[model samples]
Target: MEVAELKAIIEGLLFASGDEGITVKQLQKVLGISKETVDHLLEELKYEYERRDRGIMIMSSNEVLHLTTKPEHSDYYKKLLEVPQSSRMSQAALETLAIIAYRQPITKTEIEDIRGVKSDRPIQTLVTRSLIEEVGRKESVGKPILFGTSKEFLTYFGLTSLDELPPLPDTDEPEDINQEADLFFERFNDELE
Candidate 1:
């Protein structure tokens, strides 16, 4: 196929893939092209968008390729797509989810330990929402079920991979605990509104 045709096909794949970028290998396999050809096509396509003033561009991030609006266009188009509404969790559920997202493969007891509260309700809510799942059985005294975020979580969070999750501070503690709590509750209250 001509380079123009290859670029068009790759752009189609990227647009259809949305925020979850397609991988280079996947593109080559789908297009039945050599790696070098695919790599060259991608660069050409990237340049084409910029040169033509196209609103969207192809991007490769975390081994995934996707067509997305150029960053400057985000404020203009964000509302048009209505980025999927991730269900707002209660304070308890948020705490539970934060723990799971940060320390996945964690058990119920561990969550309870961190929160100093029962996790049954929050765990059930997260499970019902399909945010987390039983990853595997931990080889421990009782073989507790380990839980981790699912692909849905990745899509919901607008992440191509788990590595996209922002690194959290080392400690959850605060000598100025009250200030942090106030800020959190303020934003949490805003979301509720």
Candidate 2:
């Protein structure tokens, strides 16, 4: 492949990697190129971004490369972070929030079990909304991340503490469990509105 095509591929890989960033070894293996070639391409891409005055730029740390907004654009990013929450939560996000709120320090697997579906998107939404966070890791194998409500959750719900949450009614039936969750979501949404 041409040098230009190699640089483009490296740029795409960096962008797609997001915050985790792509390691030098990973890039070399994927492109089937030598480490020196990957390093040279990355430096060229970095210089091009700087020379062109692009809004986004390539960043490297500890042999990992990722794309990030230029430092000069910090003001714009701050404005975005300060934007008010004008949108309502989706049903899946509401359900995921309900599960996390009630079951403190729960793992994704436990949340999925309760919701009866993959909860990755909903969990990500909750984290983005600042309603939930990774409190710690479970002690079992793999030590999966344990999520719990953030202080933002209390502020959003107008509760001073988790203890202020309404008591759940007792029910033994499997169907009642889902109904109870829906009820909690409805009540929470009603209060917010």
Candidate 3:
């Protein structure tokens, strides 16, 4: 109801939106507020973050708003990513990476469809770690970004080329999704060790 409460709610919405981000229209609808109020709240929030010297700031891209780390802090972020402990990938990240490594230039939606779960965080982690990158945009609706393995991927996996990847097992037999994921994990883990 109050301006402060409105701003706080908007902040939470932005955070929960993750990499996909929230649009002004969506925010307005969610909060039952007008576009002008949403815009004012966003600008005020941005100014407060800047004035408060916060690590994250509000960013707008293609009409979507997200809470993103300040670009000036990129050096620290890069170092954080380089830490040995951070090198270990989660099962989801490994699954997403395997799909991208094999498929090459695949969309996030496609990856999610295969994994049967949202791949945003895994994709973000892979991109931040430089193991995957935006190879190009698909020609379909929205021209969604197509992700592919980066050169760093090969280096990290100790491979000179993608040709070094092991062949996939035959899919002629209908298998459970978990079985497929385990197969991928086992193959990659063997390669890693």
lDDT of 1: 0.75
Off by over 4 Å in 2: 85-125, 148-193
Angstrom error of the Cα, residue 192, model 3: value is 5.7
Q: In order, what lDDT does every prediction score? A: 0.75, 0.84, 0.85
Candidate 3 shows a clash count of 0
lDDT of 2: 0.84
Q: Please, what is the TM-score per model?
A: 0.46, 0.57, 0.57
Instruction: Give lDDT tens digits, candidate 3, residues 1-193.
Output: 9999999999999998898899999999999999999999999999988954689999989988989999888999999867776345787888888888877889999988888778889998899889999999999999999999999988887789999876766665323444564575557666665
> What is the per-residue lDDT of model 1 for residues 138-176, given as tens digits with 9 covering 90 to 100?
889999999898887677556698786555455557323
Off by over 4 Å in 3: 1-9, 16-20, 51-53, 60-64, 71-75, 78-85, 101-105, 115-121, 127-175, 182-193
CA RMSD, predictions in order: 16.3, 6.5, 5.2
Candidate 3 residue 151 C-alpha distance from true site, Å: 8.4
TM-score of 1: 0.46
Q: Which tens-of-lDDT digit does each residue in 43-139 have in candidate 2?
A: 8888888965588888779878779888888999999989887547878888888888888889999988888877877888899989999999999
